[model samples]
Target chain A: MTHPKRVQLLVGSPRGKRSTSTAVGSYVLNLLKQKGLEPLASLWIGHILKSPEKIDEFLKAVEAADMIILAAPLYDDCQPYIVIKAMELLAAHQREQSTTQKRHDGKLFSVIVNCAFPEEHHPETVLRIYRRFAKDMGFLWGGSLAIRAGEALQGRQGKTLDDIGSMAKKVKEALVRMADSLSKGSPSADETLSVIPESFSHGPLSFLGSFFIWLNNRGWAKQAKKRGEDVNARPYME
Target chain B: MKALILNGSLEHQTHLAAIQEILEDELSKAGWECESLILHRLKVGTCIGCFKCWDTTPGICFQDDQGREINKKAIHSNLLVFLTPLTWGGYSSELKKAIERMLGLLHPDFIKIKDSYRHRKRYDHYPSVLGIAVGREKKDSEEEEIFKTLIKRHSLNWHTPKQKAEVFLDKDDDEKIRESIKKIVVEMGVRK
Candidate 1:
């Protein structure tokens, strides 16, 4: 009997387990496990960036996996520098292995990217980057899922996905479908996934959504006030 | 007009430095003051995804590293030229790290700009951005497309009304690159 396909989940957020990336990634992992495709290893790219020595271990895990899921938060409209650095290393390793071992040509790769912006399309640019990176690395591109306003999926700090009650029923179903697609070695038909409905994310309702986001800034303003700092201070100005 | 050119090339230092010198000379001849930062020489830590710059300190990064000084320079400049080698069809990690640390330049509040939600400008003025990407060799059509799209997206997020980008192979003519830089500076309203 063929053993279950080995899968590895790489969390690429700098915030580690406390980030929205983790929330979405954890949900996918749970679904994958339920489908009997348990991940062989789960690694954080941020920790590897801090300790270069850990990269070898990451590479070993990658070599052993039949599928890899890259879950990350968009930074400045693209993949975070840490994620890029890790990709660079992986590409270099593949180059080195091309002479001695079989290339990683058929391994499946997919992405789950989240952003602070409420619009689902906010992560589109980074998703494009992922597509390019996958092609350059010779991996089979299984497609991606972009989550907008992912931070709104509320739960305890490190255990956001454990409490799925905060997520809308439709969103939960969409995520399960995405995970199902991954298990079957195909891309998810669902393009954009979000807690906010499409109607609320665009057109006139989008104005109200922007207003709510702006209103959310009041928390930052209150913190700035408590710190006795001017919220509008131009500290970098000459 | 004051300009800041950040060099983010790792292997071709001599070639990148030559390009920088030519651009600086042309801009100076055109009566524009120029400053440059070699990013690999500085100590810049990766952004840890903390929003303290937006909330706690308000426009100040928590880390007091070279990135802080670079932010100050970027704010005061009229044009920000990013010189980088295309790493995976995007800017090198060295350059991206510096850009990530400059998030303090934007406010946490969201604003609708042309039907999309983006961060409000923390300062009244933002410098026009130009990305000059150097490839080790001739890039295929796909790499070129990805590079251009990434720069455009980056420019939009920086709130620059006019976004400019130029890609050059390592063996491309230095004179042509200098001419391109001069054209952008002139178009940005700098006069000799």
Candidate 2:
């Protein structure tokens, strides 16, 4: 019998465990496990940035994996800088390994990118970045899923997939389908998936969603006030 | 108008220093004040992606590094130029690190523009943006297309009306590159 593919999930959010990226990554990992693929490892790239030892370990994991899934939150219109830094390190490792006897090749790569913006299309640039990165790294592009209004689907304080509530049904179904395809040694279609119901993406409900975001801003302002910081401070202005 | 140029080239790319000198000379000659920052030399750390800049501190990053000062310069400038070598069809990691810290320039509030959600500007104005990338020996059209598209998308998020991107081969004529930058700066309305 052929061995099950070894998959590694790298969480690229700086928020680490508390990030929505982690919640989504965990959901995917669980689905992959349910599909009978052996999960080689799951790691938080953010934590790896601080320690050289962790980075080395991350490099080792990448070398051993047959499939790699990168889940991250979009920052400043692209992958977070920490994620880019990790890619740089990975590129360096690839270069070093190329000089040796063993050549790295043909690892399947996919991305799960989420952003605070309500429109799933907001992270298209980031998804494109991932596709290009995979090509440059010699990985087979497995596809990507971009989630919009990601914070609304999972709480900021590390909510599990089970705690995702009503949306859990659609999310789970989608992941299962994706896992099934991957387990068959082929990728699911390239597409964006949102945890938000279709009704929430358009019409009156979309307007309501905007209002909630505005309310969230008010909470941020209150927190700023409590911290004795002005919400409108422009320290850089001349 | 005051312009800030971030040189994101890693050390050992001596051509970038020459590129910086030419850019500053031309911009100054065009009657624009210019500041160029060599990012790798600065002690700016990578953004940890904490939302403290938006929530707790409100436009202030907690990291207490050169990034804070760079953020200040970025918001105050009338024009911002990103100069870097393309890495995987995107800005270098050094430049991305500096750009990531710029989240403090936007408020945490979400606002819809052109039917898409984007962060509301924290300040009244943001600088126009220009991207100048030095390509590797042979041109990769796919990489160039990705770079231009990414910059245009970034311009939308920053709400900058004046956005331009230009890529030059490493072996391209120095005079031509300088002329190209001068044309962009002039068109951006930085008057003498």
Candidate 3:
């Protein structure tokens, strides 16, 4: 496959521009921009989905692009509702195009999925769904990268990968690598992304999971305490 | 006994509708007070990732919507049923909105289960889950596997006593759907 001249980033967070999903996706987008690509566009699905005109415009942008990079969070073990809804619309559009004897063959589809959990394994199912979408829709599979402990990045909102320093070192490197491949119009090998050398997983630091859970529990406890509510309250049973 | 059937179909398909009817009829025959909800028609809003449900009021979403009522019924029911068309090996966006809102049902704390960390359940007795996903065709086995795994992962995290995930195709007939519902009710602790 040849390199794509036009690449579009689809941000699937409900928070739109302020979301970490956008930050991560935009990081890669900036890398691609520096690689001498055309001016990039990042379409936040959350803002445009409810309006018919905006959604059509989003679809047109997608159709016009040679590649689509979907950056979304893992919700309920898979993708959020907005992402799925967007996919449903895109799938329908692709089907319509197919019926009309039109094809956007060789369009590359890639995924950057992040999860709150501190385990790389959690986002596996969502990544599989994305690969299936590409395969079924006839796009070349551009591979996927799943970020673990994405909640940790919430504190570093609005900061670029380089600005975050060590905490985001691996992620920044991964995105750069991914951008490098995309810039050459080459689909990332499925095997290359899976071997990220424990990127964002806190490799060999097993205590991070329990630490995150403890810290999460404490934060919620503090919030509940301020409102005079019990974190463990069984409201439904009573 | 009570059963809450959450129908998450975006479009009304005869096959999925037949499956819903079969499940409701079986639950009713078994002396269950069954309520089936068509999620697409509900005025439920998407979860904005605010932890208000857990941080402010434990076990209840602050958002004034049908999701709170659905979660209440789900907590009280003996069986919580999910009915949906599996999109890209997952539930439709409509059904997922309701599911995300139910996060209030789990506390922010996590407990290790089978070496994986999951949210702790907020209530004493959690209901059994039965997920039935309709696929576009029978040959879509890979997507079906992913969908079933997604349900099982949910069951593990929800700490359900019993759980089952079934995938049906558009060509699947009424009798086959009925048989599957019978198996779930009889074996998965709903018909007790």
Candidate 4:
């Protein structure tokens, strides 16, 4: 079979194109661009929810693409509702005609997930869920990349992976590695998994814990203060 | 005791509806008041990822929809029962909307639990969780394991004192389904 080349990125953050998911996903797609693959412009799940035309347009694009990359933030323990909605709709759109249970027609499915927790493993469940999605839809699993976006990016939204400077260096390398493998062929499950184990758990490296905590706490406090709201208000405790 | 069952059946498949019925009837007989929400019927808006609930106006969502109300109800309840069709081994989109908006119910600060660090609950007490993922076939696939693991993860992340997950196959008879749910209730320590 010819090498799967067409790449369509679906950013699942409600913040749309200005999200860290877009940043990370776009960086990879741009890298794939340097190769021979022609990646289509990203389609944001949150943007086309209400527009039937846009939704149809993207689903049509999915049919034409060789690979689908879902870049989403881990909300709670799973993908955001918008992304889940996209999954539901995509299932209906893609498999409407398939009579078989699993349609492995040489398509590929990969995911890029971001989480707020200091530990990168927090997105594990979401990643597994997406992998399950790949199986259910009969897409070749292209592995996943999970990052501590809120802190590593220092709560930076609307910033590209390149624009985030050194903080994004390691993640960028992993993305480049995955892109290289994808541009070659759909990775055989193990090839795309380049997890960054940046955790603040109590251990020999626990000294770095406070730094992340301080950055996150300061960012939330400053944002809350700017809006003049109590960051720690326990409304339910009353 | 009060139980909140978030019904996530997308099509109300006959077996699933029966399971929900048996769940409500059995839980009521077990000496608990049940508030079951048919999520698709409610006007729950999507969480806009606005950290306003966390940063700007803590413990509050600005949507003014059923999503906010569900969060309030969940935090106040003694038990949370996640009922879904195991979409990709996770809650359906209908059920996930409420769960996503529930971010405010968890404090953004990480609290170490066992091996990993997870966000702590904002309230003094958090309700234990029970997840029921339904499937049409009885095959034991990766989806079932993924669903179970996600629930167990939630038990830790959401700080649930007790939790259980069961996969209900469409081929399952009413008695088998009831037994599975009863096992969850017993495991959850909520069976009065």
Query: Can you write out model 4's per-residue Cα lDDT over A29-79, one digit (the tens) per residue?
Result: 999889889898788899878799999887888877888888888886788
Off by over 4 Å in 3: A98-102, A189-205, B12-14
Cα lDDT of model 3 by residue, B1-192, tens digit: 888999998865445678888898999999999999998889898887767888888888888888888988999988899888878888888889899999989988977766666898788778889999998776588988998898888788788888899898877888887887788788887776
Residue-wise C-alpha lDDT for candidate 1, range B1-192, written one tens digit per residue: 788999986644556787788778877888778998889889888889887898778888999899999999898888898888777668888788899999999988777788777888999888888887787777666666777787788788789756677777788887777777678767766653
Model 2: per-residue Cα lDDT over A19-138, one tens digit each: 888888888888888777889768999888889999999999988888888989988778887798899889878878746533345677888887777676678777787888887777
* Reference contacts preserved by each model: 0.75, 0.70, 0.82, 0.76
lDDT of 4 by residue, B92-149 (tens): 8888887887888877666566656677567888888889888877666788888988
Tens-place lDDT per residue, model 2, B90-147, is 8888899899889889877777777777778888889999888888688888878878
TM-score, each model? 0.92, 0.93, 0.93, 0.92
TM-score of 4: 0.92
Top DockQ prediction, candidate number: 3
User: Which residue pairs show backbone clashes in model 2?
Assistant: none
Q: Encode model 3's per-residue lDDT on A135-193: one tens digit a residue.
A: 87778888777887776666225555556667676777788888888888887644212
Tell me what TM-score chain A of model 3 achieves: 0.88
Candidate 2 lDDT for residue A37: 84
Per-model chain B TM-scores are: 0.93, 0.96, 0.94, 0.93
Off by over 4 Å in 1: A1-4, A100-102, A154-156, A164-170, A203-211, B11-15
